[model samples]
Target: MEDKIKIHVLNTGYVEVDEALAFKDKSYNPIAYTGLFRSNKHKVKVPVFSYLIEHPKGNVLVDTGWSVASREDYKSHLPLKGYIASKPILPSGENIAEQLDKLGIDKLQFLILTHMHVDHVDGIRDVQDRAEFILVSRDELKAANKGGGRYIKELWKDTIFDRFDWNGEMGPYFKSYDVFRDGKINLIYLPGHTAGSTGVLIKNNGKFVLITGDAAYAHASWENLELPGIINDKVRTLRCLKWIQKLSKADNCVEILASHDPEVKPHIIEI
Candidate 1:
């Protein structure tokens, strides 16, 4: 029986979205993330990451990176506007299917989509069949279904879904879903990046690791209180940033990984 919860960071691939979509007004400013939005499109390769959680109850996956089909064909699965907005690039054998195959993960207990953004949920086509149950922030699911240009409707199109929404909260900062109800794994609500952008908190034997997807683009945003580009609400995003800063201040927090942060690339963070 496995008692320890081990987390493997799977580097599925990368997607290029506008720099402004990443940092607040990175499109134009001296404080630009890369010092300048050189390209007319201002595109940057934000590494796409997924996590495989090996737990006592069952294996769980967080954020599927890209579908193999998308690599082969994008016109069929992605919105034309979104396809142009975020140019996803994947090398041979880097899709979610191959990544899971490399790890010999045939099945999963849970599949958590941090948000509905194309980079986060597009890979579902590659691994959705093996997931036992899905988890999502209720508001996110609603927003994705609203037919936004930022999301790929084809990803969830015509597919039946079974999901448990994260409806509970911890203190004033986080609304969470307590998986296993043992305080080991919590899907935290951190709105502002989207209507339902959320993070995950995992603890085992007193060690902790929290993964926030696009809640902050990199350590810079979360650590320095900088804002990301594609924001829904400035007020909400700032409040969420403060919450993250507060949580990171905890002595027990081992590491905080942002979805697109290059520093955390393809690294397994143990809990």
Candidate 2:
């Protein structure tokens, strides 16, 4: 019998942050920034998503949406717009726990993070009790701790790492590896949005899906191989985008999903 797979895209909230402000001035071409602003009206409403995957072999979570506290913490960082746009609400009409319950999954076998960004890891505490967290590498945790990573320090204050006895598994970096040798799911390294940003590839019932965590905010960016204005490493980020484009075009069954694209959010199949 063919294995069944269910996927859910849990929306945290809508955000409108300036992409140009995210990076240092003069680090990137003004044309790219100008084009993004011109095309997106100088602002983008990003849909923060957390994915829940259920397969016959195991239950997994691709990313975790921000918690209420974490959302508050994000507000603290943005004094200008923080007060106006800061709250914890899921667009899918259910909290993370409630959503899991609806799916009939009491506990998740693994919680794979695409990266340790604030919005993505904010819901970690909610699932810590019921799942083992998987990250791309220890470098991500280290970057998070040092306050040099994507997530701010205030959001990390209540991380579930301590509860897991501080034991977490990292990486399948710069290469593709099967989560289970049977090849039900695969983690592909596509760094540059962060030091260890990764993507999840799942195959079930003859369909393949690729969940890219912040590697590219929109599918158009991936198609154009356009790096985001606020990337840590320009070369690496561009390379990753190229790789995703190649994969998406060559493989008919592969669907590339981004974390913050509002256009793609509505089309996602809720589990």
Candidate 3:
């Protein structure tokens, strides 16, 4: 039998932030930031996506959407304050549970988190009863526990650690992972935006789909190798972008997909 899989992009909401706010460092050319800021300014629609991967064995979710606590905290923070002040509602009325229901996925087999960012891992609590969570590594989980970034460690305080089965690193290249031997799905570590930030590569029906979670917020950012100011390591972020570009070009089977690209929204096929 031939291997098969289906991919879907779920839109969560939109956020507006100043372009300069995204790049706080001065290592790169200032003119570049100015140009990008001016060209892409209005609230950029950010889709909080939860990808459903249907394999022959079972179904898996790449990342969960936002949770009430994270969303409330984010709304109160300065970084996200402006967008919330404007009262811009999230795009979808359906939460992760409802969305999954619409997809007809009764039970999730696996839950893979790209990182511990609030928007990415917020919905984990919602699906805790249904699936086993797969995180970056034990060290990464430790770092998240340190609690300094936008992600709230307390929110995950009740997480059932025993439910976490995978505990190995992806590789030196950012922090790497190979999900399966047959190349059906591979988790690539593209750290920079966050300490243990990662991306996913899925092979479905001969085509390769690359789901980058905040590795590059927008497709143009990756094309230009532009680093976001909020990132923890600019050097590593650029390296990941370069690698993504090469993969999209040289690896004919691969198609790069950004988690928050507004332009790509129209192309998403809802299942």
For lDDT, the strongest prediction is 1
- RMSD each, Å: 3.2, 5.6, 5.1
Please give, for residues 48-98, the per-residue lDDT of candidate 2 as tens digits: 777877766678887777654544454554332222322233444444665
| Higher-scoring candidate on TM-score, 1 or 3 | 1
Worst 10 residues of 3 by lDDT: 80-89
Error of 3 at 71 (Å): 7.1
What overall lDDT, based on C-alpha atoms, would model 1 receive against the true structure? 0.79
Model 2: residues with Cα > 4 Å off, grouped in runs: 19-41, 70-94, 153-174, 266-271
lDDT of all predictions:
0.79, 0.62, 0.62
Estimate the TM-score of every prediction. 0.90, 0.76, 0.77
The model with the greatest TM-score is 1
User: lDDT of candidate 3 vs native?
Assistant: 0.62
Error of 3 at 194 (Å): 0.9
Worst 10 residues of 2 by lDDT: 162-171
Clashing pairs in 3: 22-229, 23-229, 170-176, 170-177, 171-176
The TM-score between candidate 3 and the true structure equals: 0.77
Q: Model 1 over residues 61-160: C-alpha lDDT tens digits?
A: 9998878877888777666765665777888888988988988989998888889888888888778888888888778888888877476677877455
Off by over 4 Å in 3: 21-45, 68-92, 161-175, 204-206, 266-271
**How do these models rank on TM-score, best leading?**
1, 3, 2
